[model samples]
Target chain A: EDQVTQSPEALRLQEGESSSLNCSYTVSGLRGLFWYRQDPGKGPEFLFTLYSAGEEKEKERLKATLTKKESFLHITAPKPEDSATYLCAVQPGQGAQKLVFGQGTRLTINP
Target chain B: GAGVSQTPSNKVTEKGKYVELRCDPISGHTALYWYRQSLGQGPEFLIYFQGTGAADDSGLPNDRFFAVRPEGSVSTLKIQRTERGDSAVYLCASRMNSNTGELFFGEGSRLTVL
Candidate 1:
């Protein structure tokens, strides 16, 4: 079974604090790693997609990096508006479009 | 709209009743997906559609759950004999094509089984 585990189920950070959320996975084959941000009572918003090990992508204050076994979402100088549940999902190879997602890490940036 | 759209922002139904959730994917998007999300958990895949055909449905839990995308633009998910366990947010997402990995999601429909 393809499984994803995210650590630190919830994290509280001060404004401008920098930290990283972890997403570890064991998949049959890695196709793409995705990051999404969801707010309360709303759907998830696409953030980034990392396709290979040693690949990194960034947008604004967020940076996503992927490895052979895991992915990391680094938040730099986060603000209150950045507070949301960050989700990690993987699309396994072999022509599969379904994504296996981790439980997600709820991040709160307190100003 | 430019993004995916879902109907019935909230729905409350009694157990054993039938329910249907609708999804309207973005224009020109050929790949559509349905996922269920519970509190404190990520979205769980239910089905996927490519054009008017169901490309994958391995994630559907049981026979009671069924979906159709006849026109290939609007889709509906029907649940028969709904149970309390079925209460959750139903999310619909769409991709431009199989070549792209990012899925644009909607606000989701919150289902409450009473």
Candidate 2:
């Protein structure tokens, strides 16, 4: 079965402290991997979508990279406004329409 | 609205009662999806609709759960005999393309059954 696991269920970092959150996944046939940011009392906001191994995408202070077995979300010099739950989801197989998501990493940036 | 919209931002109902959640997608979106998110868990797919037809509903838990997207724009999720286990944030998302398109989500409706 396809599954996604995110590491460091919760993390606390000071402002300007760079760190990375990991998402390990097991899927029969990988199609796409997605990253989202969710704040309290709101729905998730889309971030990046990686389609193949060695693919990388960046937005502002966030950078995402993908490999065969895992993906990493690197946050550089994050501010207090960047604190949110980071989620990783994977779409498996060619004909699949659903995305299997990880539990997410709760990131706290102390300002 | 510029984004997907959900109604009844919060609902508190008794066990065994029925509940309905509504979603309005962005104009001209052909694909709509429903998901449930429990505490500390990722959102789980419940159903998907394409142009007023249910394309996939394998993620729905049981017979108590049903969803419909009539007129290909508005969708509603119906839950019968609600239980405490049904308490969660019901999310609605819409996308322009049926395949390989990113989904835009709404704020979601929080349902609490007691």
Candidate 1 per-residue lDDT over residues A7-110, each given as its tens digit: 88999999999999999999988889999999999999999999999999999999999999999999999999999999999999877778889999999999
B-chain TM-scores per prediction: 0.98, 0.98
Q: Quickly count the clashes in candidate 1.
A: 0
B1-113, model 1: which lDDT tens digit per residue? 88998999999999999999999999999999999999999999999999999899998999999999999999999999999999999999999986557999999999999
Off by over 4 Å in 1: none
Report how far off residue B22 is in candidate 2 (Å).
0.2
Compared with the true structure, all predictions reach lDDT values of: 0.95, 0.94
Q: Which ten residues in a row have the lowest lDDT in candidate 1 chain A?
A: A91-100
Per-residue lDDT of candidate 2, residues B34-80 (tens digit): 99999888899999998999999999999999998879999999999
Lowest summed lDDT over 10 consecutive residues: which window, candidate 2 chain A?
A: A91-100
Best by DockQ: 1
Q: Quote the positional error of residue A4 for candidate 2 in Å.
A: 0.8
